[model samples]
Target: MTRKQLDTDIVIAGGGLAGATLALALTRAIPALRITVVEAFPLTPDASADTYQPSYDARSTALAWGSRLMFEELDLWGALARHATPIRHIHVSDRGRFGATRLAASDHDQDALGYVVDNRWLGLCLMSALVACPQVTWRAPAQVRGVTNNVRGVAVQVASGEHVTELQAQCVVIADGGRSGLREQLGFRVDSSSYGQHALIANVSTSCDHGFTAYERFTDAGPMALLPHGSGDRAGHDSALVWTLTDDALERILAVTDEERCQQLQQRFGWRLGRFTRIGQCHHYPLTLTTVNEVVRPGIALIGNAAHTLHPVAGQGFNLALRGIMALVEQLQQAQVRGEHLGSLQILRHYQENHRRDCQSTVRFSDSLIQIFGLDIPAMKLARDAGLVGLDLLPGAKRWFARSAMGLGGRRPRFGAVTQEVMDD
Candidate 1:
């Protein structure tokens, strides 16, 4: 029996946010190109559907200013606006210490520093935009069974239903996730290390209004953040909580009831939010740092978590990946202009080279922050506290931090043709 062969210019494995966003960007950038996205879980363009897939679930994401610009460029921001809550200010401090710093959007001359949007809403927006593109062929509920690289390009074996279809593409992008089987099949070496922490996440109602402010409080156990998530079903004001804890702590926390967990959270986070009245369902994710030493090969590339996974402390994971996607889109556009093969080693190499520095630097920055703050030495603690206080006092230092946190540092891709108000170097 012979399998049906489908051909496209590019085949993207994984139709999650990253894959969907890339498909939209590429279709807009190169309208003539043929693209196919294979996702294991089914996705619907209908925003009303409630099928409960992991990718389009209750998890929330923080979209940095730069990420917002990218979505704006793609014309997907308006769809997400109603569901998103702007983060006008950020309050960072060390629990039980005098170290603290505040970041205000007004001080940076920006309307908002970032936004918090539920993943379900974002998935709907991205899928809706993707459906509008006639150049894309979305294959949901399809799994990549195998991949073979040939002289011309790569051939992917996809299993959908009872049929195995062969997809031939000039380039194949692996955006499935950190544990992508395709990534390993493609022979990319991955360096994975555990952070000895687990993130306990949930949405909760606070006694006091969040006022569009996000808080990051570092504690002896780990870091905890409460990002404003607007009003939800059971609340007047709500915030999404990401509390990192030790494995033992996580076990203990998970063993208790929701009310008990809320009490524990209140004890750790303090009276800043007044009190945690209620908490919704809780989820846990083990913290780990995963990196692919080599991101590109002859006819393949990896994006999003498939490329790297960072600690959730800084909320830089998705934003950094967005920047990398933008850079890759730019390189792909340039390659097309030059009549270069999209899957050629040269084109893939160019994309990798452009993002390598930014990836390394961002990962290092987040890891360094975690290590420095987690130090037990009194001197190091004093130095870190002084650094935070210094940031609060020094306007120059604060501005630099805001710029970097907004994803505007280093070589930023032109999000749009029109001039955007951004910080000057």
Candidate 2:
């Protein structure tokens, strides 16, 4: 296949958060690029914001400060901020322990440490932006069955219902998710280890207000977090919960009555928010640490959970993926300027190299937290308690910890608009 015979410049194999965000970022940075996104589910670009109803059990993602900046560059933050709740303070403590530490946004001279937005609203915003871009095409209710690399580009086999079609693109991005079969189909080596834990997620109302504070409590069972949710009068009263529990514990928690479940939660979580008065529908997800041996190959790349899935102990999964998206976009923009094939190994290698350290550091950070806190040794417990206490007295160490959590500890990618001078070339 020749360049002229290619159907699109890129064929994205999943249209979830990672795929949609990549499409928007690429089109925004390189306006003339033609892209097609293949998603298995239906997308509603025409979703009405005015008629939108917030779900009490809606899933949410914590967008780090750096992620917010990237969205601002992409011009999606304005719409996102409407439904986002600011996490002005974070209270970290060990249940039944003597030490604790708190981080305040005001201390760091920032508006908020982070923002939590429902996944529904975030998807709507991305879909709206994608609908307005003429260079991008959506192939929903469709799946990429296979990808074949040729000397010139890549051939993508897509299936929708009874019809199957093969399209050609210079590059194919696999963002289907952590459980992506395509990655395995293409023979990518993956290393996966289960944490022997499940995260029980739900939205709960408290007897006392959250005061815009997020809580991270380490318990003998596992790590649990409560992120503030809702707005106006509902703001401080509601929170999204992620409680990590072992398989046996998870089974018991799910079998219990709602009242009993709430009581169990109160015991593990203590009375930071007084009491858990109401609980929404509960969902459970097994925790795992999965990493790909190579995130890039000739004519192919993986992003989002497809690239790496971390333990939710730190909520770094999506934020890390967002950073990877921007880095890939920056490299693709540079490749276009140089008139190189989008899937050339040279270009893909640069993307991987530039993003390697960040990926490793983040994965290590998240995994280490679980390893450290999951320990029940008496000496380990005493040391961790002292460390937490010392973290407050040591300003530099505390700032570093806070920055790491905010996703601002490393080389930040620049996703600014490509100059007209470069585009004209």
Candidate 3:
């Protein structure tokens, strides 16, 4: 295929949070490059970013402070911050144990350790931004049937309605998600380990205010987190819950009445935020630790959940994906400046090399939290208590923990700003 035969410079699979954000980053970094985003779900027609109203049971994501900075670079923080709830403090404790640790934003010299925003709102902001960029083309209610590497680049087969269209691009980015069929279609080897646990997610209101503090509690059963949710007057009164449970426990919980479920939750979480007065719609997801043997090929790259999926105990999934996005953009910018092929293996390798350490450390951090806390041996339990107490008493260790939770554990990558010329266009 020749230049004239190529449909776009880049093709992004799955226009969810990761895919959509990558599209915006690429357009801002390379003003002249043409890109196409293929998504399986149809977007809400005529959705206005300014008018988005989240539902009472809206799902939420925890954005690390570092992730906030990346959005600011993309000129999206202003819009996102409007609905975001700042986490001024984090309270972590082992259920029915004496081990506990507290982290404050003041100690880190920041306004917030992180922010919790509804996932729907975040998607709205990203989609709105993508629409304003002339260099991007979106294909929704469509599926990428297959992708194969060609001499000139990669050939992408996208199906919409009854029609199937084949498009060629310099690179294909697979951000379809953790269970990405596209990644497997390309023959990427994946290693997966089941935790034999499932997460029960829901939104709940408390009799007492949360004071903008997020809570993480560990029990013999599994780990549970309650993140501050909503904004303004509703902020302190409500929280988004992620409760980990065994298969049998999950079934029992789901079978109970709302009031009974709240009572069980209060039993596990204690009275930190008082009684769980109300519970919203509940969702369940199995816990798994998954990673791919290779994230990049000659003309392809894997990102977001497609590349790695972690235990939700630490809430590091999306934040880690954001860092990977920026790293890839940095390498692509360099490749563009050098007039090299965007899909060149050399360029893609550099991207992976820079991000490998961060990925490995994050995976270890999340998995370790689960393994260490999951142990029922008395000796291990004593050790865990000591470790938590020690972490609180040691300033250096506490600082490191704070940084890691804020997604600043590794070297930060620089993202290109949108040029004035492109802005004018």
Candidate 4:
């Protein structure tokens, strides 16, 4: 097991959530298999040098129940719990007309609606687990310039500071992100569309306690979500906002001083929390839907953002990635036990078939929701309002919808995902 850059049974090309999870799962399932993860971004020792940090990062995620189970299996939930906030209630509403729907934790007999955690914190937990997993190897600041598929396996040509080296593996998984450097190189097509909107995310403090209730208000500009932060919130600072709006509107809001922006938030958002007294650094991201042509190839497979990227309206992209990673591990484990070729085209084909339904469904769901709620047409508005009214009439319709938002409604993974955890560990 010695090669300058080669020799590995499984090579994962990205260290993001999906990649890390897949490596861990495979290692646990198949003790004999060796896994290596190549990442471009490494969690630095210095807090300031860290590109992703909990407090300052403008990005956070609404992890689904299924994803929560994945964290538990990887021994990350305990650490994640420290920085997460439970979503006790989700309030969905439209401005002007009183069309709103509320889903409370009580309806589901759960403590909260869902969990929201900072991406940086979650990533850190994952990295920590990776370090302890004996079957896994971590490589970072490495760029994959080429990939060559051979008779035995695939060869990954990496450019680590001008010195090129080849890493061999039976299969290569792409977890680089939505914009993967190796996606096109693997001969797959990707499609994307801008929503003509930008999302401005930041952490804010409020006068009143939100009590774990998250607000998904459909403002005249666009949809804005205010999710609660987990435990360490020290009472006063408890919420984070993901405000999406037209580019022009977003720019106008960003131009003003933080003082004015806080006021605007208060004006449009009302005093639900009295007033947003202070906001952390404001960051912006373009809202768009990116879909890849396929999830699997002969010697390469794509997971997470590399496979399909959707509008953040639902926040299921990352969760979906976790599910895919789980499934891939299951398939590889069975293949290994059966003495089957893990990197064979037939194997990936079957894996793709199992995940295709969930991938397409999630992408379509997010795209459809964005178009549906974003419409201001009179008839569409009437229809949407009527839909909400219908949902309210049904006792648990709102709760069911909330579960779907958690990414727990899709096809069950073969390894089996119960309620949400990996079935039978």
Q: What's the lDDT for candidate 3?
A: 0.91
Question: How high is the CA lDDT of each candidate model?
Answer: 0.84, 0.90, 0.91, 0.76
List candidate 1 segments past 4 Å from native.
Answer: 1-6, 45-57, 231-236, 415-425
Q: What's the TM-score of every candidate structure?
A: 0.92, 0.97, 0.96, 0.90
lDDT of model 4 at residue 91? 76
User: What does candidate 1's lDDT look like per residue over 74-147, in tens digits?
Assistant: 88888777677788889989888898999999998898899888887788778777777888998889988778
Give candidate 1's whole-model lDDT: 0.84
lDDT ranking, high to low: 3, 2, 1, 4
Model 2 backbone overlap count: 0
For 309-358, candidate 2 gives per-residue lDDT tens digits of: 99988889999999999999998998888778899988888888888899
After superposing candidate 2 on the true structure, give the runs of residues whose Cα lies further than 4 Å from its correct spot. 1-3, 232-235, 417-425
Compose the digit string of candidate 4's lDDT tens values, residues 1-425.
23334488888888776787787777666777888888787656454212444564446888876777777776668878877778777777776655777777777777665788887777777766667778787777787777788877788887778788898878888888877878877768888898889888888888898878788777667878888874645433568888887878887898899899999888777777787888888888888788876678777888888888777767677888888887787777766666777788888877888888888888887888778888889988888888777676677776568778666687756453322232233
Candidate 2 residue 38 Cα shift, in angstroms, is: 0.1
Give one clash count per candidate, in the order shown.
Answer: 0, 0, 0, 3
CA error at residue 92 for candidate 3, angstroms: 1.0
TM-score of 2: 0.97
Please list the Cα RMSD from the true structure of every candidate, rounded to 1 decimal place: 4.8, 1.9, 3.2, 3.9
Give the C-alpha miss distance for residue 111 in model 2, angstroms. Answer: 0.7
